[model samples]
Structure formats: structure tokens, C-alpha cells
Target: MALSPEDVIKKSFSATHLRRGYDETQVDDFLDEVVVELRRLVSENDGLRTDLEDCRASRGVASGQGAAAPAAQGERHEDAEDTQELEALRRQLAECQEARAAAERRAEEAQERVGAAERERDEARSSLEAASAGAAVGASAAGGDGEDPSSIISLAQRLHDQHVAEGESTRARLIEEGDTYRTTVVAEADERSAELQRTGQETHDRLVAEGQATHDELVQTGQSRHDELVQTGQSRHDELVSTGEQTRDRLVAEGQASHDQMISEAEQQRSTVLEDLHGQESALSATIGGLQSQERDLRERLRAFLSDQMERLDGSRPTS
Candidate 1:
């Protein structure tokens, strides 16, 4: 016969002829402890497996049961919140994208501005150079008049120096303005990018927290349902066993009564008793047959459940 964990714990083994076998008491204790732990693990494994199956089965039951309606409503509310959050996030992303586009446009505009500024500066320098040339021509003409030639030359030199200083000052101011505008544009772009990053991180964190909470709720609900199913199954099993025991006991008692009647009754009554005993035997057989059929059905269901479990486990197993 196949051994259950309990049987294994209770079993005794024949000693080896060579006196080379391990110590029996120690071995028995170890094996029994192992069996107990194994049974516990098996029970826990079965519970977890049942919980998963029940959870899968209950997916369709989200809104049906009375209490389930509230749960479903809560779930729907959560879903609504999630949808709203997602929509909000989408809007934020669109805004961020728009900001990025705006920044890009500004950068392009900044380049254009810089280019225009450079052109303006170049034009200013060119105008200054042209003016300087004109001034030089005027100074040369004045110096060439031959009246106090040295004084005329000195005055012309001073006027030329003033023109040169004015041109340099104007160029410096133009360059400074372009630098300031470029710096401002760059700083705005950096700030927009940073804002987008911060918003993205916040959205990620909110989604993660929501997902974790949902997971915990599902696990807790599944565990509660699993425990309920297990208890119901156990109660039904116990009831069936008790019914079978009662039927067996009644049959045995009737058989004893018939035996006594056969021993004490006359021939005619004995025949009647014999017929009653035959009827009782047939009933006992029927009861046994019924029990056997039920047992077979139970066994078949168990085998199917085990096959499904094995297949599920195999599919989930990781490959090296």
C-alpha cells in the first residue's frame, strides 16, 4: 500500500543482518519530523494554489454579490481615479512637450536674434569705419591748408581719436546686449526641462504606489476567499464521513438482530428473518456501492485538480 506521511511516521523497519544500519530511534524521529514539516508545507502549498485559482475564478464576480458591489464600486472609483490621473498626466506631458517646443522655438529665435545682432554690430562697425575714413579725409584736408599746419594737424588728430573711442563704445554695448539675451533664453530652456523632469518623476511615483496598493488588496481578498472555501470543503468531507459511519453501524446492528432472530425463531419465522437479512444485505451492498461511486468521483476530481496544478506549476517553472 502507498504510505501517507502519517504511515511513514508509524512504520517500523527490519534490522540489517550485518548490524550496519543506522540507529532506528534517531532515524524514526528524524523521518517523523521531516514528515510533519512536509505535511505542513503541502498544506500551505495547497492553500496558496487554491487562493490563486479562486482569485482567477473571482475575476468575473467583481460586481455580482451584494457586498461585492461595494467592493466593485470601490474598485471602479479607484479606476476612475486612475483614469483621471492618467488624463491629467497626459495633459501634463502635452504641456511639457509644448514647453519643449516653445523652448526650441525660442532657441531658434535666439539664434536668429544673435545673428541679427551680429549683423547690426557689423553694420555699426562698418558705418564707424566709413565715418572714420571721412574724418581722416577732413583732417588731412584741414592739415594741408598750410595755416598753422602743426595746430591744424593736432586738432585733426584729437577729433580722429574721439571718433575712434565713440565707435569702440558703441560696438561694446551691442555685443553686451546680444550676450545678455542669449543667456536669458538659455536659462529659460533649462528651467522648462527641469520642470518636465520633476512632473514625470511624480507621476511615476504615484503610479507605483497605486499599483502596490491594488496588489495588496487583491492578495488579501483572495486569501480570505481561499480560507472560506477550504473550510467549506472540510466540513462537507466530515459530514459525508459521518453519514457513512452511521450507515455502516446501522447495518451491523441489523445484522446482529437478524442473527439472533435466526437462532431463536421457528422454521417459518426463520425464513422471514432470512428474507429480512437478505434485504439488509442488499441494502448494505447498495450503500457500499454508493460510497464507492462517490469515492471514485472524488478521486477523479482530485486527479484532475492535481493534473491542472502540475501543468500550471510546470509552465511557471523557470528554465536555466
Candidate 2:
């Protein structure tokens, strides 16, 4: 029976598995290559079929013309050429069919090989399992050879105890390391806090001193200017008392406007400083949260490692 393209591809994949010992990836690659070749063959076959059809149509046209003109030399020559071309196409088609058949046969053989290999692999696995079970039974029988089972059990218990003790030691060591890390973190946190506090205190003291100096300078300037103005105005006070009152009113108005401007500027500066401080605090909080998360992850990893070690130790422990 002729195999379909899909069957051929499947057989090819199976063969690859048989030859290469059940490599899925290799089988897939082989199938892909087979598909590419199959597609090429299909295209060629279609082209050949089309060529054959054209040849047959030409032969039919020649035969009709030959029937119309029984002795026409030109018609006879044309008939001969058409016959030759048709023969050539038939031959080519036959070759393509033979090639396809051979490919299918090879694919089938590969599939059989793969099936055989799989069966052998399964048999080997079964043999191994049986052997292992037999060994366990033999070991059990040997244990029942008039020997004191309790003595054997006791020795096993001692070995298991020793293993457990070793694990405990390891766990104790890890705990110590964890404790050391915790202590280090605490110390760093304390140091950072102290540094921040000291820096804040120094900044506050410097700002206070600067403010006091500025205030003193302002007060002295105001007092000196007031005295000068009074001394200068005393002589002219009698002549220009109303003028002096008008000027004083203007100065008071200007000072009030300046004071209001200064107050608004100070309020804006304070708001900006508060926003900056808030941003810094938020950043620090995020940093602390990240550190805490990292610490938690580290602890989890350490625990997982310890658990894995414990499991290994338990598996290796002697059974009572």
C-alpha cells in the first residue's frame, strides 16, 4: 500500500527516535526536514502532472487534425513530436512515483527500528526494577538469619542519632550566622540613626546662630536709623511737623508692605523645605522597606537550604 505524506513523516520521526534512542528534539528536527523535502516533491509532482495534461491535450489536438487530413505531412510530423513528448513525460512521472515509493519504504523501516528500540528500552527498565526488588528481598532474608534484630536495630538507631546530631550542629552554625547578620544590621541601623541625629543637631545650631546674628544686625540698624531721623527732624519739627507726620506715615506704609512681602517669601520657603523633607522621609522609608524585603528573602532562602540539608541527612540516616 502507498503511504500518505503524513504517514511518511511519522515514520521518519519514529526512525529517528529508534536510531538516536528517543531524543524528542532530534525527532522533531528530522520531521521538519522531511516535511520540507515532501513539500518540494509535491510541487514537482504537480508540475509534472500539469505537463502530462498539456502533453495529452496536444496529442488529442494532433489526432483530430490527423483525422481531418489523412495524408497531410505537416500533421504527421506534429503527431510524432507530440507522441515523443508524451512518452517522455510518462517516463518522468513513473520515475517520480518510484522515488516516492522508495522514500515511503525507508520511512517504514525506520519506524520499525524505533519500535524495536523502545521495546528493548522498556525491557531493560523492567529488568532493573526487578533486580532492585530482588536485592531488597535478599537483604531482608539475610537480616533474619538468627541474628539479634534488636542489636541491628540499636546500631541503626545510633547511626541515625549521630546523623541527627550532625544536622543539629549544622543548623546551629547557620543560626549563629543569622544571628550575626541580624546583629550587624542592628548596629548599622543604630549608627545611621546616630549620625543623622548629630548632623541634624549641628544644622539646627548653625541656622539658629545665623538667625540670631541677622536679627541683631537688623535691630541695631533700625535703632541707629530711627535716632538719626529723629535728630535731623528735631530742628525742623516745629517748621514741618505736618510734613514729618506725612513722611512717617509713608515710611510706615512702605515698612508694612516690605514686612508682608518678607512673610510671604518665608512661608513659601518653609513650604518648599517641608516638601523636600517629606520626600526624603518617603525615600528613606522605601529604602527601609526594600531592605526588610531583602532580609526576608534571605531568611527564606536560608531556611529552604537548611530544609534541603535536613532532608538529605534524613534519607541517609540508618533505618531502625
| Local distance difference test, each candidate | 0.67, 0.59
Least accurate stretch of 10 residues (summed lDDT) in model 1? 15-24
- Candidate closest to the true structure, highest lDDT: 1
| Candidate 1 residue runs with Cα over 4 Å from true position | 1-54, 57-64, 100-104, 123-207, 223-320
Q: Which pairs clash inside model 1?
A: none
lDDT per residue (tens digit) for residues 174-260 in model 1: 556656755675576567657756876787787778767867776777667666766776775587568657865975796687667
lDDT digits (tens) for residues 1-320 of candidate 2: 75346776757322321122234797578567756755765675565455445443332322333553553455457556655655655565455556545545654555555456556555655555565555555656777676655555555556555554555555456555545654555565456556555655665575567557645654564455445444544544454556546756975896688678767766777788789999999999999999999999999999999999999999999999
Candidate 1 lDDT for residue 257 = 78
Candidate 1: residue 258 Cα off by (Å): 42
- Candidate 2, clashing residue pairs? none
